[model samples]
Target: MRIHHHIGRRTRSGLLAGLLAATSALAMGIAVAQPGTAEAAASLRSLADAKGRDIGFALDPNRLSESPYKQIADAEFNLVVAENAMKWEVTEPNRNQFSFGQGDAVVNYAVGSNKKVYGHTLVWHNQMPGWTSNLSGSDLLAAMKNHIAGVAGHYKGKVFAWDVVNEAFADGGSGGRRDSILQQRIGNSWIEEAFRAARAADPDAKLCINDYSTDGINAKSTAIYNLVKDFKSRGVPIDCVGFQAHLIIGQVPGDMQANLQRFTDLGVDVRVTELDIRMSTPANSSKLATQAADYKKVMNICLAVARCQGVTVWGITDKYSWIPGTFPGEGAALIWDENYAPKPAYQAVAEALGSGTTPTTPAPTTPVPTTPVPTTPAPTTPAPTTPAPNGSCTVTYVPNSWGNGFTAEIRIRNDGPDPVNAWSFGFYFTAGQQVTNAWNATVSQSGTQVLARNASYNGAVAVGGTVSFGFQGTHTGSNPSPTSFTFNGKVCANG
Candidate 1:
């Protein structure tokens, strides 16, 4: 579901003081930490607080009764968005017959927890009642205005921001307006009318235009960008733009940061709304590690942008994730798993958010040796010694292919006695494949030869250990994998 409205911009600095106090409390061990190593123990909310940005999750009201679900929700997130309770159908199912029970439950929980509420959708194409589609012309416009007024006015000060308009643009090709009932009957002017009504109802809220598949600079995002530009020029009461970054594993766009920068350059805040990266599951360690890296990459991107307000994952845990039902054979989207245990992704997100903050205690200095041992001088005559065997490696390429594009996960295993430090792997694509984006490594291509160097966090490969990275590419005809690979200039066996 999607909604849109025009609300005012919020002052981010105001949140810093309170958040800092909360962060201090957390560091002092007053707050509950997830089960793991010391570094993974910091709550995501506290880490994000130190950076002056909110880390949020969509609340499923039904799950609020569950101990584990509510525990994580209250402890890890600073803001809450109702997954479906605030939508048009749920808010006002039968025209003028408003129901705030479900919506109020979510809002009440957020208020009690001292977390801010983000009202989802005042006007959206999906999840509206059948009666809404029956109306036409002037009647339709009036209904739209009434719905926005009722919903926005009720949650007036409670909601810090609103997704005033959601998914207004078409999906593919040369993106244009979607042919929803509102668009067909009331025309494009309906969007502006909805925003106007929302502004009048709740003048203090920060309003936004939200959409999916526009996390990167693509045709769909460009279309929304044009709309935002036009809205700003005409004094449309929009304050932010929401990128529903519903991503796939290893498919994060290479230009994601640049794309967000362009939107924020237009003088409106940007948010990563509805974030969840899904992969084929029955989860495995390899896929979970990749997911962790992807989540870290996203959080880092948001931190890099000055006007990115915050990030809100669509759901709190994988058990309640919408991916498994919507996209069969795909699950394990959120940082927490089915049993509500923290996964590698939880640590990754915490580390990313904590990157900008100073440690509570200073790191200990390394001790210097007072006396150095004498070293033996080199002999003029060469002394014979047993030679050490060269390191061996194997590369396994697994590709998920489609018509003209594919994503491949490549794993490099070190099969030698000694560890490979600061490793570099090189290979060639023989099927006219061109890599477009990659994760967990720094990959560069010159013709068919591609070189992938380990990232700062994954530079060392221990003996009998493996490191994996993936890339998305386009191919024509046969998409054949490389028959061989080289690790640190030594040819590796193919797997």
Candidate 2:
């Protein structure tokens, strides 16, 4: 489900549990529970791993020739994709041929480190052994059956996911060329056969249908969606739809995130498979800058969605890019350069991941308060300016279906044990998902801040009445929870 040149480093950029601070370090035999987390349910949501990134390579065992495999073994990627190493030819060359040397190496490496392994595919048109092209009817089905059973059964529970079907829909339309064996020999039903056979082999692995030219909302993408939709309706056992974003330098498909969300809304997980940014030529400065922007945008979109679980870069470096050898006149589509040094795009990715400190965008700003007007007459004594109350609010914010925004309610309490004038709370959301609605609180979004107005309930909370401040806002890349929630000049613990 992914493509790449050789092994190189594309430095890249997911979620984690609620970021709770440890007031004190662990002092032998002591543990502290994080507050505000929902209690563990009998069957918890899989949102824990709902975000990730990928690693892959071409059809070569010599990927180690580029550098010590340890280089990638130490990276921050969440998953590793064994590109062509698992294909029919490489995995099974002759009759009953089962060569898992290269593929096993990658899998073992990933497993040893507790990372996820997404089986490249059980069926693919290219890289298939030449002998397969001549098979027909029963022979074809038997061949496919053996292929799926052998590979899927071999890995089984060890795999986190499987690319059961790849490139099933073609950009040229008509479900791809009629001559393609998958269509010609067994017809489109082969896809279902492959999935069913794979499930029979390994019921635990999440099965996905991966394809290129379907990363955006296009004809081919639509066709694939309908197929998957119908299959799911009929209990076909499909779990996710993979978007192959083998993008150009600056042309990442639009509506890619929303497209993924729609599929997620259908109750299927979504992933970005075989992601890469190919330039007109390698080492082009302008192209590299654009590639940086492209990488940032890709990470931003994935971070903006809740069900987008994984994103695997086609490969790590541009030096070994599949573009030059595969497409000719195009290459340099990765994060690392020939020297294995990080590229600008790589650094941008690190920043997007929150480990790097390069400021790609401005920081969110807080709204300013208004000052009292002066009296020109100077005759009457100026009335004393009212002071805001020293109250606090409890806001339980839940990120929405899309990672772009969240919803919450802030409950105000008179912490100072004294009645005061009003309560005002303000904070900034980098993307400003916007405040859809609010009550007992006036809200507005500008630049990146959410300004809320809260007057004492019943003109003053009567030394006991309470006011609440709460609203939702869109989230951008690499940001943690909002740190600025205040009521009457005092910051709330969690806002």
Candidate 3:
């Protein structure tokens, strides 16, 4: 769901002709592109890559058709997240029937460009097919499973991730689960069931629970933190936690990094899913500078955390940003201005990524302790296999179970005298297990064997440093831990 209130009604049909003309103009190099005459600078993607991170942008196909948006998106970003195409209403407008044309087009374009695609959401309160509102009990639960399976399965491996569940917590009232048709009819377990269904259908895409106002350790964020903790302690198939950084100028949360770190510490990946800083119309020099600082703070924090995967701006340019439509009198929320030129904020992000220091925010003089002071929590289960003899690395495999679906964490440690670079960990699951969602590492599977490579930030570990990643998987009958483990192709000595 959108953090800002979108005014009036939204209709894809209404903007078709205008977008078509914009596309034509862009092809002919006759459009009023905003980036004209702006000096070329290092792209955010390149800078992030240097730091072993990913830079991304959320897109509406209509906006992508415009030359300015397309040019910047293609050059500056390597990840594409569908802004509205994958929502429930758009994908399943008429009950049991499904139409994936819009979402498919977005994925197709991303694949053609060699970009990673993140599906916006599978379950959200704001957008739902009319047919769903009338259902109750089994009907509603059935509908939920059907929709998730259909949409997630249609894209299958094409989408790298999905916002499996979005905005499930209320801002007030003890931070309880938000009241929606799904929860109202199917009970609180709907969330866990949604993840389970998604894993069964795709078995590869990363599934995330996304929301706004979670940038800090506040009541809402606390509620989410507890939920994730419970999910991990048990065996819910949650992969990542998404924080929608829909912020105001000069108001970046001081504890944002700490909040993210706590989630990753729970053996899940964290991402800045939808980021935009909106300000009053006619932004002055000071406002722009403040926005730049806020942008840099976010970039630095993400780059600092090994489990912080990527950062995605809500939209590429202020010209098409949802701020103006949703929040009256508030505009200019993105990195690029209306004319497609890089704003001061863009430069700040680039500089932060280029710098090699850990990003830090000024601490509040008086802070509220949302949870315990975080310590390195040992893996829940002991190492399943023995340690490597000649190799100085060890692995601990832990799995939390529920029904036939489970979430697993893999912790890899360097116990040798030297550091390791570009590390890889491989294992075999004897129980016909298949991974559905993974984070903090690049994961792939070949039959019963699974391989996990380090992410851009976590590849290098010091002599005694430990780096870990996790995923959700499904199994039939008895689920047993892998019998053996390998570190960079060397079998461990101790079992």
Number of the predicted model whose lDDT against the real structure is largest: 1
Please give the ranking of all candidate structures by lDDT, highest first, separated by commas.
1, 3, 2
lDDT of 1 by residue, 45-95 (tens): 545655778798888687877655665675567789988889899999898
lDDT of 2 by residue, 438-482 (tens): 433456555445567642221244344444433333344433555
TM-score of each: 0.65, 0.61, 0.65
Name the regions of candidate 2 deviating beyond 4 angstroms: 1-61, 65-69, 173-178, 356-495
lDDT of each prediction vs. the true structure? 0.73, 0.58, 0.71
Worst-scoring 10-residue span by lDDT in model 2: 37-46
TM-score of 1: 0.65
- In model 3, the runs with Cα more than 4 Å from the true position are 1-39, 355-495
Superior by lDDT: candidate 2 or candidate 3: 3
Query: Candidate 1, residue 53: CA error in Å?
Result: 0.3
Which prediction has more favorable lDDT, 1 or 3? 1
- Measured over all alpha carbons after superposition, the RMSD of each candidate to the real structure, in angstroms, is 19.8, 17.8, 15.7
